[model samples]
Target: MTSPEVDFTRRNPTARPLTDKERDALDEFVDSIHYSSRYNDDHYEYRHVQLPKQMLKKIPKEYFEPSRGTLKLLWEEEWRGLGITQSLGWEHYEVHEPEPHILLFKRPMNYQPPAQH
Candidate 1:
């Protein structure tokens, strides 16, 4: 939630798949909600089908949309990607993108650092 990332620890692989526990977390966000879960041999991803009031709520008080890109910025700072060297590839990050709304939680699992900055 903090990072917008689906944490990809080995046991969970595609990172933390939403379980009953995560679903429970969404209660705070749910006025109504729906989703679809998908999986490959290795990873899993669940797309948000519907957003209830709780999830639509603003950061502190009222209801609004959740900006995943904004969340990802906070998350990268928290994760310290800023401290890592920048590469043309996945090992480095944009730190911030031109479109904050577009960059969600994405950790390139197959990232290979490019030769130049």
Candidate 2:
């Protein structure tokens, strides 16, 4: 979805073009848009690791999935710096603690982002 500034530029090519900042803003906005429709049926490489009980202490409190008895870390706060995490989405993946000290990271196996023209 585009902002009003983008829409304005699109509707009026003859009008004033987007400023450098506006163009950068539009690029950032466009990058942030998740095209779910294009990736609704993505294939993921499911993998898990057994973490030492001590490592559990580092997990953020908000990530605990109490109902499932798991922790879901979809962003890059805790484990993104690791090589394994980088192979995963780096900024994506999940951590499920089906059992104590165990984590399952589900990442897209071969995700290809849509080409930008």
Candidate 3:
């Protein structure tokens, strides 16, 4: 299945830097989102990890998926929003949980942001 696209520019144009507390809140929110989404679904296991502030900055607030209870990291959001798919010669990105406190997101090898015109 394919993920949905989100217009980051329109969603969070000039998103301000989050404070330390907000960063923590984002982490907690991600956990809650994952848990709520997977609690009743046997196919998914709830898991979460702290991401660096730099990495998190690229993510749009709307990507948190509060309404649908899903987690959308920066790379996934970018991939979807840019309309680059595996069938379109775009490499797939992977979400990595290296440890309990670190979540790594690997961007597609050849992704280029859509030119703003």
Question: Highest lDDT: which candidate?
Answer: 2
Measured against the true structure, the TM-scores of the candidates, in listed sequence, are 0.23, 0.39, 0.24
RMSD of each: 14.3, 16.5, 12.3
Regions more than 4 Å wrong, model 1: 1-31, 45-50, 53-55, 61-69, 73-117
Top TM-score: which candidate number?
2
Candidate 1 residue lDDT tens string, 34-104: 33342222322222233333342232211111443232222322222212122232211222234332222
User: Where does candidate 1 clash, by residue pair?
Assistant: 7-15, 8-15, 29-54, 29-55, 31-52, 31-53, 32-52, 56-64, 57-63
Summarize candidate 2's per-residue lDDT along 25-48 as a digit string, tens digits: 334223222212112224554445
TM-score ranking from best candidate downward: 2, 3, 1
Better of 2 and 3 by lDDT: 2
